[model samples]
Target: MCLLLGVLVGRAVPWMQGWRTRAAHRAAEQKLDALYSQYDDIYHRWDE
Candidate 1:
């Protein structure tokens, strides 16, 4: 029973880590996109 539990945990841990990594990467990309959008808006307004 313990061995089974350990094996399950071993698999789960890597999967969870990968999921967290992807989420963080996605969040960073979103933040960068928002920043660029804001910058573009400000630039266009200034140009007018």
Candidate 2:
């Protein structure tokens, strides 16, 4: 499943690299999981 998904994503990689695609990706990522913010907060909390 992961391998097939990788191939599928590979086919879309060019589109994913475009600015419009990136914006949509960002929006979808944020909606799916706030991993970016949580990751930053984890590091900052460790620093503190």
- Per-candidate TM-scores read 0.72, 0.35
lDDT of 2 at 40: 85
The per-candidate count of clashes, in order, stands at: 0, 0
Q: What is the C-alpha lDDT of each candidate?
A: 1.00, 0.85
TM-score of 2: 0.35
lDDT of 1: 1.00
Sliding window of 10 residues with minimal summed lDDT for model 2 = 13-22
- List the candidate 2 regions with Cα displacement exceeding 4 Å: 1-27, 31-33
Candidate 1 ranges with C-alpha deviation above 4 Å? none
Tens-place lDDT per residue, model 1, 1-48, is 999999999999999999999999999999999999999999999999
For candidate 2, write residues 1-48 as lDDT tens digits: 999999999878777679677799889988667877887899999999
